[model samples]
Target: MSTYLIGDIHGCYDELQAILEQVNFDSFMDTLWLTGDLVARGPRSLEVLRLIRKLGDSVRIVLGNHDLHLLAVYAGIVRNQLKDSTTLLLEAPDADDLMNWLRCQPVLQVDNQNKMVMAHAGITPQWNIDTALQCAREVEAVLRSDSYPILLNTMYEDMPNHHHWSEELSGLARLRFSTNVFTRMRYCFPNGQLDMICKDMPNKAPEPLRPWFTLPSLIAENYSIIFGHWASILGNATPEGIYGLDTGCCWGGELTLLCWEDKKFIRIPYAGIKHW
Candidate 1:
């Protein structure tokens, strides 16, 4: 059986299907790991969400920032400008089921048997794999609880980039920190402060502010880390033990899928709109 890891789909359902065809994906025999951002910014968000949900155990998906934003929208915690672009999803007949499934998806996933970990963005330099998993569970528990609607109210925002995490952080602060690291994070300071404003290519994020995977604290990691969420990298990052699979398909680049067993990238070019 072959295992595949795909980058962010961002509502590019056609491209996703093309890549699956390229890989000859067999739902019964092959497993797919998605780097999240399953919906948003493209033509068919609802279709993409339904297709992945239909895949069931054949797929593993971690939540991405866009996915969380969708949850916040569905929960009535916030109204996004993307309302026009996302109306089809929010108004879908199965919207509640889709949103519930999405919120329940973890921000971090650990596959010890495969010796790999998956997060939508990248793990904090402050966390080792085990600690990261524990942190994920903390957020997941809250997401799965009765307080989830209340938590969504505090999910959106860029301020308060807390570098150090402690058990002392409960309520909104802790959940936001966990959300940022697992979803919105890309670049970070050496001291682990998140750089939320910079979404450009790695070299353009300003010096001293490095990609999260390059942090000195993470140099000792022995297992592979798979992530998406950095479309600007366009699947070009070659950092050791780090895999970036977002190829910017929503912005006219290619959809990328990596065969876990052989590490071969299967790319499908976008044939639709060139700019979003």
Candidate 2:
């Protein structure tokens, strides 16, 4: 069974289909692992969600920052950011079901069988696999509960009470910290605080805010991680086992997929869908 890991789709349904066909993804045998951000920015966010949902158990997804923003918008916690496409998803009849399914998904997924960690954004420097998984569970619990909207309402904040974890953390303070790491992380200050605002390349990430993977704390963990968030960096910021899949399909860039078994990249160029 071939397991394929795809980068940020960002509502590029046509590209997603083309890539799957190129790989000849066998629904029954070949597994599909999405690097998240499955919707928004492109013209077919709703179609993308429906297609993946139809794939059922064969598809594994982690939530990205955009995905979380979508949920927040739906819950009336935030305004819609996907003016181009997400409104279609929000207006669809199955919007409730789709949002429910999306929120149920983990922000961080640990695949011991595949020997990798999957999160929309990269993991924080302070957490190892076990701690990271535990933190993810905390956020997952909040998202899946009736109080989910409460978290969404306050989720869009910079950094947190602290960059590093502490056993004393509780309530939204703890939840926000973990959620940001899993969905919005990239660069961080040397003190371990995430640089949540800079969506630029590592070189442009500003002083004291170095790429997350370059930190000694995170590098020491040394686990294979597959993530897609910083499309600006694309696949250039590879630090050994870390892989970036989001090639900015929403911005006229290509959608790339990585074959897990052999680590091969299968790229499908965008079909000229004008986002502007």
Among residues 3 or more apart in sequence or in different chains, the pairs in candidate 1 whose N, CA or C atoms overlap within 3 Å are: none
Tell me the whole-model lDDT of each prediction, alpha carbons only: 0.84, 0.85
Per-residue lDDT over 1-276 for candidate 1, one digit per residue giving the tens place of the 0 to 100 score: 999999999888999888898888999999999999998887889999999999999999999988888888787787856632678998989988988888888888788888888999988888787778877998899888878877677766667555456768776788888888898888887788887777777877787888888776542366788999988878676577789999888888888999999988888987777656
Q: Could you say which candidate leads in TM-score?
A: 2
Name every residue pair that clashes in candidate 2: none
Off by over 4 Å in 1: 82-84, 161-163, 218-220
Model 2 regions lying over 4 Å from their true place: 81-84, 159-164, 218-222
Total residue pair clashes for candidate 2 = 0
Worst 10 residues of 1 by lDDT: 155-164
Give lDDT tens digits, candidate 2, residues 69-113: 899989888777645578989999999999999999888777776
